[model samples]
Target: MSNKLSIVVVEPDRERAILIVDSLRAAGDFDVSVISEVTGLARHVSSRDPDVVLVDLTSPSRDILEELTLASGPLDRPVAMFVDRSDDSLTKAAIEAGVSAYVVDGLRADRIKPIMDAAIARFHMFHRMRLELETTKRALEERKVIDRAKGLLMKARGLDEEAAYALLRKTAMDQGRKVVDVAEALVTAAGLLS
Candidate 1:
């Protein structure tokens, strides 16, 4: 991937958006787009396919936060929201909505780069955790399928667990498929037979 990051600044105020864009430009060479209107925000942000999103709101409402949740897609990219002030409930809502970074009373030109960096890093950390979780869940599901297949073989062919697994492995090797795939097929066939 290129080093240049495509950023989308969602600021209703034109002047503030310009300042944020200028700060980003000063930090590094970045592809930045500004969304001044909050209407159809999801479409605007998605169209840009930005690497990161920076939202500046004077005082965010629940409705706006919901809109931002749809627009930011916290899992897809890092989103840093800057607000003048906030309460516990609003802060909780923002984090729950998948905002990577929620800054309160800290939107200065000098602080922009560091905040952006932190948001990206935090997002990556969460992304890695999510991927690892998905991998673990998939492995567990595959193990269950394999065990079911083994049980079916043990009952039908009077084979031991090891022998049943060997059969599955052999079938997978012969077919140029994964052991899990063969096991899944066996399990599906057994289910259909029942």
Candidate 2:
């Protein structure tokens, strides 16, 4: 467990996973751990919070892509893929899914060593700045969404500002979603139906 940096490899092949771990450890840059599935990776991300995620992907899955996209987007976590398949569509989807670096098959110590360092460093730098920006933007956006939803609630349901806010809060609580999420849904539905 290196305090400096960590990378979780999503390789299901026990042999390849071990090899990747050895190679990465040999690089002497990263503390590498392997997770066999997306669920394991999610838990690893939440608990370990690795500086960079190196997913050894053989194919694509929509749920994984969405999770990766959301994890990388507002959270600004950096994820890269050690991909076996080079299909154009898969590459495009991986990029879209927030995989920062898509390394092809030739993952030698010398070739991928520097890349691993650079990716981890850049991911930390960019992730920090992106997190700050996203926090500010989220706050501002939350206010706007809540205000819009409140306005709609007052106009359509004849409620005061406090009552409108309460309605939004109640909906969020009942649905087990964030207040901002509820507000956004209200705004979208209003736009569509009203």
| Number of the top-ranking candidate, with TM-score as the measure | 1
Candidate 1, clashing residue pairs?
A: none
Name the top lDDT candidate: 1
Cα lDDT of model 2 by residue, 1-194, tens digit: 43445566666668656765766676666676777665544555545655545652323532363354344456555443444343455444444444344332234434444545543443354446768999999899899999999999999999999999998999899999999999998899889995
lDDT of 1 by residue, 1-194 (tens): 87566677666767655766776676677787878776777667756766556653233522453344343454543333543233455445435434433322233434444546543443345456778999999999999999999999999999999999999999999999999999998888888989
- Give the whole-model CA lDDT for all candidates, comma-separated: 0.63, 0.61
Model 2 quality (TM-score): 0.37
lDDT of 1 at 89: 50
Model 2 pairs whose backbones collide: none
Residue-level lDDT for 158 in candidate 1: 100
lDDT of 1 at 19: 60
Give the TM-scores of the predictions, in the order they appear.
0.49, 0.37
